[model samples]
Target: MPAEKKAYPLRISATVLEAMQRWADDELRSVNAQIEFVLRQALHNNGRLKPAKVKPLTDDDTR
Candidate 1:
């Protein structure tokens, strides 16, 4: 299963929102997803979130 995402209400100026919308469209992502992607990148760049570890799965693990 994928990790769940949390939602929070955000307030921003119209100018910024418009800019984000344009960037999101250019990147082929929804506005909400684009925001999350940018925020995650920022956190990762600042060393706040360590890269997730990927482990090979066995048949039992899948079950």
Candidate 2:
């Protein structure tokens, strides 16, 4: 599935930003992609991602 993206501004210290740039270079990903990858990884590690809920069919929709 294709992922959705939104543009947002961020503030970070130069030290952290430089470290992230170097990390992104090593991973061959844009700095923004690298940041998203790291965040998703952290969320998965902590079991923060929840499965989507499914809705049951209702009589009204049967038409």
Candidate 3:
């Protein structure tokens, strides 16, 4: 199951928001997703979160 999510209000400057929007667009992700992606990366880099293990794809799974 996916982890439960909690909502939090964020306040950001327009300049930074615009930059994030552009980056999110380039990566084909919503601004919220982009933000979460960046936070997750930062946490992993700081050793605060462990890396997730992904299962390898198999022919049977592809069907």
Q: Compare the candidates by TM-score and give the number of the best one.
A: 3
How many pairs collide in each candidate, listed in order? 0, 0, 0
Model 3 C-alpha lDDT per residue in residues 1-63, reported as the tens digit of each score: 566899989999999999999999999999999999999999999999999887789999989
Order of the predicted models by lDDT, top scorer first? 3, 1, 2
The estimated TM-scores of all candidates read: 0.78, 0.72, 0.84
Q: Choose the strongest candidate by lDDT.
A: 3
**CA lDDT for candidate 2:** 0.87
| Model 3 bad stretches (over 4 Å) | 55-63
Model 2 residue runs over 4 Å out of place are 50-63
Point out the higher-scoring one by TM-score: 2 or 3: 3
CA lDDT of each candidate? 0.91, 0.87, 0.95
